[model samples]
Target: MMFQLQIARIATAPLPVWIIWGLGLVTALLLFLSVLLHELGHSLVALHEGVKVRSITLCLFGGIAQTERDCPTAMASLRVAAAGPLVSLILSGLLLGFFPTTKSIHPLLGNLFGQLGALNLVLALFNLLPGLPLDGGLIIKALVWKITGSQRRGIQVANTTGRILSLTSIFAGIWLFLRGGGLSSLWLVMLGCFGLGATRNQSQILALQQVLRDLQVADAVNRRFRVLEDDQPLRRLSQIRLSSTADQRPANWVLVCRAGRWIGYLDDQPLRDLPVQQWDCQVVANHVRSLDELSCISDRAPLWQAVRALEHAHDGRLLVKNAAGIPCGTLDRCDLGEAVLHKLGVALPETFLAASRRQNAYPFGLALSQVVDSMTATDLTEDSV
Candidate 1:
């Protein structure tokens, strides 16, 4: 273990290692720096458009610039999204111009500069492709959004186009592999698969954006989570869980109430970690994800609004309150994602199916109805703290 730790330290050392490093370490560093610069362009433009740039990440394929808020207008989005590619194109031009002068310095330097120029050009042009998860896709999405005034429709169009192109690339990769193009062909296959997987989520996003805009949080509120007093014993809660139906996705967290006031939740982990003898003495309030730590949204609010609320929330789960200012339900992140996939014609995972089968004996596999029926609610007091 100590040797492994030392090796990790050596590998992650701040200073670059010459020659010994693989993947053309110096070249890779230059590429990464260039990508970072490109992302900075997008960030600066997003700021100009009044959108807060949250983070810029450079990954294996390229980079992504995430903003705290989505652009309010298609024109604003177009400019922000186009900035990165424009930066790359500029860098490409500069490198190409300097490559000739570098030949007098050293052949190695000239070759390196030439390759950097080529890579930048390729980066700019590749991102111009009309597909999802690409700058070109964003450009197309913004244009379509502007014309139709429906972001969902724009996403659907890009998703469909990306699917066709990704499938074509996959076949092309396979052909190259068969012709002994070898490792490079394998890379193409991998890139195609990555693109395919990434774009698959677009369909769900489109469906969600459509449905959420029309529906309210009240329609999909989950009230099945049990509320427990903060003074309650861990053993008692554990017993309840062990005695309950053998649902694999059984509620792992319990809502905690302190003197009739709603706190956040009591995760079951501490219960299992604590000694059995101390279980009764250790009150839930001692370890809870506090109510103040979570965010609340109106149950009457649209589902898309709740989605936005979750994005701003730290824990990704919101305490859904009714008009009376009573915490009526919990809106979980996973639940929202599941709703989107369901709307996109994706079936629930097998774990959910198995859980439902054991939770209800309803005929015709309508256990979901029984699950809904089983959600018993206890009215919250005025001082539910």
Candidate 2:
């Protein structure tokens, strides 16, 4: 994840000696407090929902309460989301009650408080917009989930609504921009763009999930593969890859060949740290591991289950074998992602998958599964696919 800091936080910094420090300090403090309170709304609700509050970030975009886990139900999600805006609304109301009109206090303090109160009110209202990745969208998602009895379906509905809302917001922002609405209009356009990007990510995730639901390792596994031998040097194995044709890349493990029969697999970690120049000289057989140390599953296992295994093991790939203990094929995280993308009808080039595999990209298998499940549910419902 990218590191982010709240724009409201900058005010906490000491001002330059030459500037009007008092005014800057006062404005900064007020903005910080308001943003913090708004985020607290979300944190408190999430805590109530049995979700861990990771952090509350009060950035330029306002407050974001990061949670350790997603709420269990739509209602829980809604409540957690609604908490922040509700807090903001309550704060705004309190401010209003304290000063019916910002008429009596010093101009600076009064204006600051009034602005903070109004911003909170706006925050509450804006978050109530029923499009995804937003508080309002979460509410809609929860409602849809309640009605549909599927969280994935709710996400699809919410995401579709989010796209529609985002597009409309973009068009309106554009119109405002053309009509001389200034910087605020520009900000609106940017926000719409952000919404669009988030929607795309959600759509991709859903697609992958659907594919996982439909696929089984049995369908994709190649039954013929070599396993690492225990006695061979890492350098010798590296040479085999160097001499292979276009179809073969260096297998991470070579089959332990004993009397021309497969016995066990070898560990490849020792070879990983060796210098290229020493490739053919070192023995790798001593570094080999028995079959029990590795997690192997039959080819007929569901792709989702396999993915979960791969994730838990923290390995780049899993070895697929048949019921007879014969090495069948391997499932790399990248292969799963590519397969998911293919099912989604996304036209990613084969080279991208290959490159990503070589680079060892992070596993998004679980995310893909979730997305596919959501899309499948949505498609069945005819309301939002």
Candidate 3:
């Protein structure tokens, strides 16, 4: 059975699918708005610091503020991060004040606004926890940087704090589940899981940044890649496998090229799901993910910045462009990993087999575990301390 259905079955009965979906949509929309306001707070502060706000995206996790440049000082970074939660808190307070002793407004709307206000309050409070990727975490990191005179040490400390918070939340969530609470308990567990994953990702990115401080995109790009025409049939490319024998398959995936320009990407998953006979009838253009909406990085962009962009975009791959806005190469997470490892003077294995395995086992997960473990390793790492 699908995970969605399994979760639904575990939830309360008498909750019809349409109603549940409606409520979910409403909640998502509300959360999106709240996150937007929060990110806007950050963006506004970033603008004041002469930092450019690139864009904002609202996803299942929350909203993110994409900035064109990093803040020049620890104080600026702290303020930029703190601005979001501060806005949330202020908005919550305003809502609470407006609804104080309310008896005139409809009960349903009042309840909704009250819940919204409460959610904002929770958002503010939760974000205040000292950890990386959180406003409070950045604030604490800034303070640590100020004292230690080391940005790396400050990030390490903040990330460690984040992992501890994540673990505590997970434990608390499990306890809540054991107590026979409903969906709210399950949601707590999921939230904790999400927080853990996000915190770990943040730490991994930081580690890579530290390792590849001066590296650029030009250092790790696969310049020679095949670009396919939109009208091409998948059968032709599938026959000519570029990789080894083990990787040979129907070439349903292709990079869309038009008028000497890289336009988009096309995958064969949807076509493969259908009957084999229907494959010839489908066009590759139909499956394309538009390049206009996808993230592309300049060839001269720093490796660390490119990695951050990939993480923020959550896309495994990005098209590398030259000065003339033409596609020059492709850069993915693996390329970034290899570059970092190479720069660190890690030995390259002789055989292709060993190299592939080593590259695949990049220390992203272990690095995160270490970051978290470091928090408990010292007495000063405790939250109370």
Candidate 4:
């Protein structure tokens, strides 16, 4: 509605109210399309560089291209980062070029073309600002990576610059608002706050990347799980649960074995259905699941990989395997979260930890997947830190 009003106010060739509104709607859609195309430019270049594009999202702030991984090299990053703004600049030029021709047809049409062209130009230039969460910031990262051989350092510089730029934008917006600049001023203020928030989020991700660098799955492996022979009676399983602590409690799901080979697992949930008298009648094999169906991760692999596995796992848990390809223990969402927070020097509250253990999930819904992606993109490693 605001856009339509803005468009109506801009119309000068004396057009009907409905026609002006229609044109305004079209202009709004075209603007969104322009943002989509801008993101597509980045995604296409990322794909060409052997990176998989997961999704492209159009949000209130702008468009974002979520890729599975980062480019292989600095030059590749530069190419991918520059592609979006380059496409926007080209679009601006083309639209502006067509403006005169359209204006000859109708003033309203000309106005639409002119507005779109100018906005695209602004989009290109605005995104070119050298700061984190922006194309220009990434360009800066690529350059610094090429020059100093350290992407982490590049990220630090970019983040700092982003904070400064965001603050400046906020202050500028406030000045504009005080001078009666209205909605445009508020837009700038909101954009500034958004950018500031994005920069801080990236900073936290970088910190997590530091925590995960060169860390292995074995470091965070939880050994609280029990292994039970398939022939073992449910009564025997019940006897083992007499003594447990918060940190040493046995996992609810225990690994099942048959003839010295892992067969499946048994969940404690179903055991509650039977009476105590039936405990001796049921064997572990009665409720066994196939071990092959479980999501397994190598104990020696990077911890980040385990985090990724947990992120995609339906049950949010993984069966960890040792060097001999034998099941060692398990790593769940809580375990991974505890490990990460431990490294970051942050302690989880007992209540939160208890809740997470009860639900078998990360504490406070921490998003390790996003942090892992950022870590992968920045080439963060132990040596880099």
Q: Which pairs clash in the backbone of model 4?
A: none
RMSD of 2: 8.2
Cand. 3 TM to true fold: 0.52
Model 4, total clashes: 0
| Model 4 agreement with the true structure over 223-263: per-residue lDDT tens digits | 76777899989877777665445454335557888899987
**Native-vs-model 1 lDDT?**
0.69
After superposition, candidate 2 runs with Cα above 4 Å error: 1-21, 105-108, 180-184, 227-252, 256-262, 266-289, 311-315, 323-326, 346-385
Model 1 spans > 4 angstroms off = 1-24, 221-300, 305-385
What is the RMSD of candidate 1?
A: 13.2
Stretches > 4 Å off in candidate 4: 1-14, 59-61, 98-106, 179-183, 225-235, 242-301, 309-330, 373-383
User: Order the candidates by TM-score, highest first — what do you get?
Assistant: 4, 2, 1, 3
Worst 10 residues of 3 by lDDT: 376-385
Pairs in clash, predicted candidate 1 = 260-384, 260-385, 261-384, 261-385, 262-384, 262-385
Number of the top-ranking candidate, with TM-score as the measure: 4
TM-score of 4: 0.75
Ten residues in a row with the worst lDDT in model 2?
1-10
274 in model 4: Cα distance from truth in Å? 12
TM-score of each: 0.59, 0.72, 0.52, 0.75
Q: After superposition, how far is residue 11 of candidate 4 from its true place, in Å?
A: 7.6
Root-mean-square deviation of candidate 3: 15.7
- Between candidates 1 and 4, the one scoring higher on TM-score is 4
Top candidate on lDDT is 4
**Native-vs-model 4 lDDT?**
0.82
Candidate 2: tens digits of C-alpha lDDT, residues 261-373: 66666545655777776656766655556665666777887666666666655455677888887677777667666665656665567676556666555233235434434
What is the full ranking by lDDT, best candidate first?
4, 1, 2, 3
